[model samples]
Each structure stands twice: as structure tokens, then as C-alpha cells.
Target chain A: MDIIVTELTKSFAGHIVLDRFSAAFPEGEITCVMGPSGGGKTTFLHILMGLMSPDSGTIKGVPSRKSAVFQEDRLCESFSALTNVRMVLDKSFDCGEIQAHLDEIGLGKDRTKPVGEYSGGMKRRVALVRAVLADSRILFLDEPLKGLDDQTKGHVIDYLKKHFNERTVIMVTHDKEEVDAFDARLVTLG
Target chain B: MISTMFRKSRLEKAGAVFLALAIWQIGALLLDRSIILVTPVAVAQRLFTLLPESDFTHAIAFSFFRIVGGYFLALLVGSVLAVGAGHYHGLEMILWPYIHAIKSVPVASFIILCLIWLSSDSLSVFIAFLMVLPIVYTNMLQGIKSTDEKLLEMAEVFRMSRLRKLKYIHLPHLKPYLLSACSVSIGLSWKAGIAAEVIGIPDGSIGEKLYEAKVYLSSADLFAWTAVIVLISVVFEKLFLRGLKMFFDRLERS
Candidate 1:
């Protein structure tokens, strides 16, 4: 089912973050949300993910199972990249299957090292892979590729395109090329 | 470069210890009173003699088990209580006054008070537990409270299980705090535990030996027993911390 946001309103200390904002994210497609900084793009995503509640609004059709690549990589620092991804999966999943996906995203060589030792761009890709592989009906990406260089960014965008599957993906970003790369519908918020 | 620096530090430490020993030897010679302060050589001789005695082995075993047992008990109970209080603010509030009392009360008062309720034999165990409990509880609670909120939110969104959340998030964050707590508390437990034993004068305990040395005015025996306590404390701390670190390393790898 598609998620529908109706007149969503949120404020922090009387400053409005989201003011009667309405949007619809169709199921099984990528919808990129874009706006200037501090424009409540992240707040909107947080509300839809149930991390925050809108002051006055109604949202419908949000699935119970959801996953996210937060603004921060949020990877367990001491754990390896493979362990970080494996944590969200059930026992039935094999490590070999996870390693194959990590290989596709160029993290195969460093899967054994702790994520604490990873570079910022490498950490971001690990977080992205974790989100994609999690058992979820929807995936939220908040500045998922923020720290990547242009070269790595292109490669990761390809990986996302190949792996995102049919889940509803709602990403917040400032880059227009990323939007065009996915041919994703854009929603502006400010 | 790091290995070279480490070697230099080791040499400096050895030099410092030698200088201190020289000063001690000079002071002992000038005083020329074995009753007041014995020479290090005399104390070393006394320790070697005591090492062969069955009573010495028995005393060491008696004190070692009680003090170390108390420390392990505190570690287990403190971590469990801290995790419980971390999840429930009401529970924390309820436990506040008791933790406060334990922290504020003098060790001597607790020892005397516990003597009325507990046998002298188990006094060191209880005392050690009392000394270490608050340290572990407070540090673990601080670690739990200070866990990164962003990672928790990510876990929630991913529908992660409680066991997974603990393994991936809570345990890793708590490692440093737990290590620090253990280091500080281990030494404190031994000091307090031995003090309790001395007051109670439990049979077959290191504390009983110390008290006997005091009564008999054997400074060499006194110094020897003190050195034994220090050696045991240091060895225990090193072994426990190394084991804990290995556990964390294995956890991260697996």
C-alpha cells in the first residue's frame, strides 16, 4: 500500500518544521524528497518511519516493517561490516549470501575489519547495504550518500539501483543528479 | 617507534624502582631496628620462609577466594541492576537512597554492623561486595544512558530484536565503562576485603596472619604479608582485564 500524508504539521518551540504538508509515496517505487537545509525533509521522513509524531496530521498505509540508512552511518563501531549487516537478518540467512552482496558494493575486501576502521564513504556504503538487505516493506535513506566522493557516489548509485528491489524507497537528498540517476519523482519541502 | 617508546618506559620504571629500594635500604640500616622497620632483604627472607609453610598457603587461599568471590558477585549483580535501572526510571529512583547509603557509610561502621548480622568468616566477602557495587552500577548506568541515540533509532526502524540490540549497540558502548569500573573496583575490593578480615580476624585468612604479626611485633612478617597481598591483587587485575578484553575481541570478530 502507498503511504499518504494529509496536512502533516510539526513544530519545534513555535518554529514550524512541517506545516500542513501533504504528499503520497507510492508503493514499490523510489520517491526522492528534496529541500534546503533545516527544511523538515528529515523530520517528514522521521514522522513517516514513526520515529517522531506529527503534531497535527494523519498518515495512512505506512507498513509495520521498515528500515533506514540514517544521516549518520550508525554502524556498530567495533563490529565488522559483515556482522553489521547480518544483525538485522534472521538465522536462516547465510553469511555467504551476505558476503556476495558486500562484494557487489566493493566492501568484500574489508568485511573482516571493524567498521570503526572504515573511511566515511566506506561506512556509508555499508549502511546502505544494510538497509537494502533488511527485512522491510519500506526503506528510508536520509543523506545516504552524503560523504561519498563523486567517483564512489556513481558506483554506489548503480548498486542502489540494482539492489533496491520493489520496496518503497523514500530518500532525502540535496543533489539533483541523484534524483535524475534513479529517474525518481521529486517532492520539494521547505 | 611505538615499541621503542614502550621499551624506554619499561627501563625508566625499572630505574625508579631501584632508586626507591636503595633509599629504603639506607633508611633501614640507619634505624638498625628490625622491630620498627626491617630491611627489604629480611622481608624477602621472611616471605621465602613463609612460602613453604602450610598455614601460609591456607591463609592465602582463604583470603583470595573470599575477596575475589565478592568482587565477582558485585560485578554480576551490579551489571544486572544497572541494566534494570537503565530501562526503568522508577526503579532507579527506588534504588537511589540505598546506593547513596552504601557510598556514604564508612567501611569500619559497615564492618562492625555486619559482624552482628554475619559470621566473621564471610565478612570480607560482604565487605568487598559493598565496596565495588556502587562503582560498577554507576559506570554501567552511565554507559547505558550515554549510548548513541541515533544507533538506537536505526535499530528500532530495522525492527531489530532485543538480543541483537544489546549485542550490536549496548554491549559495545558499555565495554569501556565496564573495563574502567573493573580496574578501579578490583583494587578497592582487595583493600576493603583485607581490612574486614583483619578486624574480624577470621581463621586461616591473610588478615589473621597480619593481625598475628602485629601482636607478635614481627615487622618482617608484616611487610612480607603486605607484599603478598599486593602481588596477588596486581596479578588478579591483569588476568581479569586481559580475559575481558579477549572476550570483547572475540565478540567483535564473530
Candidate 2:
């Protein structure tokens, strides 16, 4: 089901972030939100994911199951890269499946090393793999390719496009190259 | 180069200890009074000879178990209370008075009051427990409070299980706090346990021997028992902390 937002309003301490906002996030399609900083791109994603509530709005057709790659890597620092991915997954994902996902994401070289030792781009790839493998109907990725080099970014974008089939994937980014890479539908906010 | 640095530190420690001992021996000799301050030689001789004595062995065992038992008991209760309190401000406020009292009260006063309420046999255990509870609770509570809010947000978004949150998030945060708590509380537990025993004069306990030493004015006996207490405390602290470190290392290991 598509997510429909109508007249969504939110403010923090009398400063408005979103006012009379409306958008339709097409179901099973990749949509990218782009705007200047403080334009409520993240705020909108947070509202859709139930991390925040709109002061006055009606949102329709959001799925119950959800997953996300937050702005920060947010990987379990002390756990290995494989364990970081597997923690959100259940028994259906076997050990081989987890290893395969991390290996594909370019973390194969040192899956045994803890995520705390991983570089920023490496940690982001692990977070991406985790979101893709999760059983959520909707996947929210906030600035998923910020720290990565162009080569790594291209690889991660390809990985997301491949696994995100038939799933509602919403990404927030400022980079036009990232949006073009996914051929994603654009939603601009101010 | 690393080995040389390590050996240099070890040599410095030995040299410091030797100088202290030499000063103590010189002081003992200059005093020319055995009752005033027993010589290091006399204390060492007394310590080795007491090993074969059945009563001395029993005293060591008796105090050892009671003190260690109380330390473990405090660890269990304090950790549970701190975790609970960290989750709720009202619960922490409710518990504040009790923890404050435990911290402010003198060990001697607690021992004397507890002796009136409890039997001589259990006095040392209760004293040890009382001395350690607030410390472990304070350190663990600080640890829980200091947990990263961002990681928790990530966990909540992923809907991670409680067991996984504990194993991955909470335990790592608590490792250093728990280690410091054990280090601080273990020494206090032994000291308080012996003090209680000396006051209660429990049979076949270290405190009883110390009290007997005082009553008879046997400086050699007093010095010998004191050395034993120090030795046991150090050995147990090293072993327990090493085990704790190993436990955390395994948790983080892939």
C-alpha cells in the first residue's frame, strides 16, 4: 500500500519544521527525499517510521513491519560485522546466509574483527545488508552513502537496488549522483 | 624493547618494596623493644610457623569463606538494584536514603549494632555485606546511566530482543564499572569482616586470633595474622579480577 500524507504539521519549541506537508510515497518503489538542511527530510522519515509523531496530520497505509539504516552507522561496536547483521535477523537466516551477505557487501576480508574496528564506509555497508535482509515491508535509509567513496557508493547503490525488489525503499540524500544511481523518484521539501 | 620496559617496571617495584622493608627492620632494631614494634624477621618467622597449626588454618578458612560469600552476595543484590533503579527515577529516589546511610555510617558502628541483632557466627558476613552494597550499587548505576542513547535508539528501531540488548549493549558498558566495584568492595569486605570478628570474638576465626593477640600483648602473633590477611586479600583480588576480565574478553570475542 502507498503511504499518503496530508497536511502534516510538526514544530519544535515554536519553530516549525513541517507545515501543510503532503506527499504520496509510492509502494514498492524507491523514492528519494532531497532538500537543504533543516528542510524536514529526516523529520518526515521519522514520522513515517513512528519515531516521531506529527502535531496535526493524517498518514494512511503505513506497514506494520519496518527497518532502517539511520544516519549514524549504529552498528554494535563490540560485535563482529557478521554478528551485527545477524542480531536483527532470526533463525530463518542461517550462518551461511549471514556470511554471504557480509561477504557480498565487501566485509568478507575481516568479518571476524569487531565492528568497532571497521572503517565508516565498511560499517555503513554492514548496516545496509542488515536492512535489506530484515523481513520488513518498508525500509528507511537515511544518508546511506554519505561517507563512502564513489566506487563503494556505486557498489552499495547496486546492492540496494538488487535486493530492494518489491519492497518500499525510502532514502534521504542530498547527492544527485546517488538519486540518479538508483533512478529513484524525487520528493523535494523546503 | 618491550621486554626491557616491562622488566624495568618490575625491578622498580621490587626495589621499592626492599627499601620499605629495610626501613621497617631498621626502625624495629632502633626501638629495641619487641612489644612496641615486631621486626620483619620475627613476623615472617611467625607467619611460616603458623601454617602447620590446625587452629590457624581453620581461622583462615573461616574468615575467608564468610568475607568472600558476603562480597558475592552484595554483588548480586547491588547489581539487580542498580539496573532496576536506573530504569526508574522514582525507584532511585526511594532507595537513595538507604544507600546514603550505608555509605555514611562507620564500619565499627554497624558491626556493634549488627552484633546485637545477629549471632556471633554471622556477624562478619553481615558486616562485609553492609560495607560493599552501596559501592557496587553506585558504580553499576553510574554505568547504566552512562549507556549510549544513540545505540538504544538503533536497538529500538530494530526491535532487538531483551537478551540480545543485554549481551551486546548493557554488558559491555558495565564491564569496567563492575571490575572497579569488585576491586573496591573486595578489600573493604575483608577489612570489615576481620574487624567484626575481632569485636564479636567468633571462635576459630581470624578476628578471634587478632583479639587474642591484643589481649596477651603478643606482638609477633598480631603481626603474623595481619600479614596473612594482606596476603590472602591480594591473591584473591588478582584471581577474581583476572576471571572478570576473561569473562568480558570472551563476550567481545568473535
The estimated TM-scores of all candidates read 0.97, 0.96
State the lDDT of candidate 2 residue by residue for B159-201, as single tens digits.
Answer: 8889988988899989999999999989899999999999999
Candidate maximizing lDDT: 1
Q: Considering summed lDDT, which 10 consecutive residues are worst modelled in model 2 chain B?
A: B149-158
For residues A1-190, write the lDDT of model 2, one tens digit per residue.
9999999999999999999899999999999999999999889988988878999999998897888999888887888988888888885679798788788878897898998988889888889988988879999999999799988888888788889968998899999878899989999887
Total backbone collisions, model 1: 0
lDDT of 1 by residue, B160-209 (tens): 88998988899889999999999999999999999999999999999999
Question: A171, model 2: CA deviation in Å?
Answer: 0.6
Determine which window of 10 residues in candidate 1 chain B has minimal summed lDDT.
B245-254
Error of 2 at A23 (Å): 1.5
Clashing pairs in 1: none
Q: Proportion of native contacts found in each model?
A: 0.94, 0.59
lDDT of 2 at B3: 100
